[model samples]
Target: MSQSLDIAVIGATGTVGETLVQILEERDFPVANLHLLASSESAGQSVPFRGKNVRVREVDEFDFAKVQLAFFAAGPAVTLSFAPRATAAGCAVIDLSGALPVPQVVPEANPGILSGLGKPVQVGSPSASATALAVALAPLKGLLEIRQVSLTACLAMSSQGREAVSELARQTAELLNMRPLEPRVFDRQVAFNLLAQVGKPDAQGHVPLEKRLVNELRELLEAPLLKISVTCVQAPVFFGDSYSVSLQAAADVDLQAVNEALEAAAGIELVDADDYPTAVGDAVGQDVVYVGRVRHGVDDPAQLNLWLTTDNVRKGAALNAVQLAELLIKDPL
Candidate 1:
């Protein structure tokens, strides 16, 4: 018989948090008791799980000892404050915020990293874009020596959380009525527009999101010095993430080999040449990373170009967390 475990989901009222709850139920994780937690503002609210309304309790007042595992979908502040507390209480923590001080993980790409980690593993989930990028590139890692990667990520407002989604919706409605648009969640009008910057730029002029993509890709792929550059843009849509990736290999690449590698990759759906995936039209609510538009570079057979899309909230965050949880369940640290 499967052992039932006690689980707590922090930030249960937010976008990724709510999605995590749905995925847990959908995957039928063996849960003895599920605790839904959120900030004081979100407390008293109820989220549906296993056909029941689980009332969200304030994280500040919750008891971490009650749960064996805790999934953090909250922002950095909440994670930094509570993750340690939960860990000290002997609860394994999987942080989806991408900000915690723990080993960043993508289960499909590197489940071996979890082995021999000692008891009560605490790990951080990769950023949504990093999740998609790593999954697409992992299959090729064994086939070709990837020297460099250049990517452009088109992210939706949902990446910023539910508030950003609401802001985009309000701006769209106001724009349709010809009313003045106020940019609240974003620095500029995000409705019917694109912003080149996703987060604040660093000393090297790389935004946090771009820097994170580079760092996480390296760790997930186990390529310490891989050259990677990414341009992140906030799209006008509300969900899903679309990416244009260019990979430069160390040796001459074969087109057929690349296609076969991608097609055989786990959690990747290769699209037909005549068809392509759109974030809103095709990738929403999907669990797999959709890859299409595979082609060789104009002059370099050693280089490849591919278009990829994924439901970032699911495969990128919640699903990845759940998969890691399942890994822990199968091979307890």
Candidate 2:
């Protein structure tokens, strides 16, 4: 007998939300009913779900009493206002915001951690860390205790949000048409530029998103003391994320064995130089993590350097949320 579950996607019109819908349809999740919720401005609009149209509802009017699972992607504000109510109503909330203060999930990188949560696990981590976690951890699984990691991410405009995606498209059209460029949704022109930050500034100038990555990565890896240094930059690319990870681990780690482990791991792909080696765009729409340029650290042979990429929207955010939902369905609470 097939199980029936009512699935609700909050923020269904946003970038991650839209991508989640596409993935859910592509993967054919066992959704008995699909509910799309967004702000009032987007409410009443229709979105495709399982080949049929599902009308978007206003978040304020959403009823969670009969919802078996709710996928919250709107933001922390909405999640805080509604998540508890949904949970109290017997709905398991899978939040995409950092608000719930729980699992910072990268499903391919870490699965089963969301299990036994008794309710939803909020996903934190920036797009950078999500990609890094998926690729970097593949090689070291169970073999090396990663003590410290330093990562610099080359991110896409999509990380900023859907409005940024639109801004990029509008600016690109203007550029190709030889029109003057104006910027919004980004600090400056993003069509032919790179920005070093995302989200608001902290006292040290680190964005909230970047700080979340450090803490979330530590929690996800179960290495609470794991030291992480990160610098996130937004590139002109449309999708995907790329990173260079330098890790300090135990003594005399075998690069060959690490590479072998990554090559054989599920949901990961090893890219060779002859394959035209690396690019952020290469990760778009791909479900697997891509690893390249694996080498020993210059300072210490125990340390390792790796280049990683994944579809920022796929494995990084949307697909990861969907993967968690899938896991829940396959194995109930």
Candidate 3:
């Protein structure tokens, strides 16, 4: 018989949280009991799992001690309000909201750090762009001496929330039907058009998502001062995220070695050179990051470029958080 522990999932009604529940069931995680929680407004909803539907309860009314582990998948404010209670009750926490001022981790990039954490573990998951980059780059750290990484990330509408996702669909349908479009979630029209930026920009003209990528990617790669330039654009996509990455390695880069490294790496899928991958076709609903278009700079052998894609909500958020739980349970939860 396998050892099992009680688990609680915060924000269980959201897309990522629902996906988290689905993954837990699909992976056959040893869950003795499952606790679904959300805000009062979202409570009373039911999520299907393990051949039955689990009714959600309000987070404010639920006791953290009832579960050995809890996943924080809500907004930063929600995490801030309830995480302390869970931790105080000796519940291990995996925060996907990036609220806590902790080191962001990716299972493929920094699994070793899991064993060294203090008791009542509190871990933070990296952003989507960071997670994909870490999975693709961590394998090549030993192969190439990287000095700088420049990336342009095309993000899906689901990153903004369900409203944005619904708005994109509505706008697209209206345009197809030759009807006037009205943008609700976003200030401007987003259907069939790319948005220049993702989140609000600071005084330095850098958005939160871009800054998060630069910082989280460095942490995941264990390079505190690695130079990273990231630009996040809101694509007309609904589910997956795409990245065009260029790494400036010191001296000449061995293209064959890079290809082989990515091929052997866990959580990455190497696409054939003749065919490229897209967010919708290859990455959505997939757990691994797809890597293709592997080549060196047109004239500069020191520069390496690659294209990567992954399911933002699945692999990037829910599965990554769940993978951390899988590791934690091995050491006794």
TM-score of each: 0.97, 0.91, 0.98
Which ten contiguous residues of candidate 2 have the minimum total lDDT? 119-128
Cα lDDT of all candidates, in order?
A: 0.89, 0.76, 0.92
Candidates by TM-score, descending order: 3, 1, 2
- lDDT string for model 3 (265-309, tens) is 999999999998999999999999999999999999999999999
* Highest lDDT model number: 3
Best prediction by TM-score: 3
**How high is the lDDT of residue 163 in model 1?**
89
Model 3 misses residue 116 by how many Å? 1.4
Residue 145 Cα positional deviation in candidate 1, in Å, after optimal superposition? 1.1
Which digits, one per residue and each the tens of the lDDT, describe model 2 over residues 1-333?
A: 238778889889888888899998998888788889988888888888777888899988878876788888887898899888887778877778778865666665667676646544343433445545654684475777777888888787777787877888898899999988777777678787777877678899888877877777766676778788888888887777788788888776788888788878877887774552355556778887788888887867888888888777777888778877777676563
Give the least accurate 10-residue stretch of model 1, judged by summed lDDT: 110-119
Q: Over 4 Å off in model 1, which ranges?
A: none
Question: Across residues 1-333, which tens digit of lDDT does each residue of candidate 1 receive?
Answer: 249899999999998999999999998999899999998999999999988999999999988999999999998899999998999999999998887867888877877888856668898789999888888888888888989999999998889898899999999999999998778978889999999988889888899889888999999999989999899999988899999999999988887888898888898999988998888877899988999998889989899889999999999999999988988888653
**Per-candidate count of clashing residue pairs (backbone under 3 Å):** 0, 0, 0
Deviating ranges (above 4 Å) for candidate 2? 119-128, 173-179, 273-281
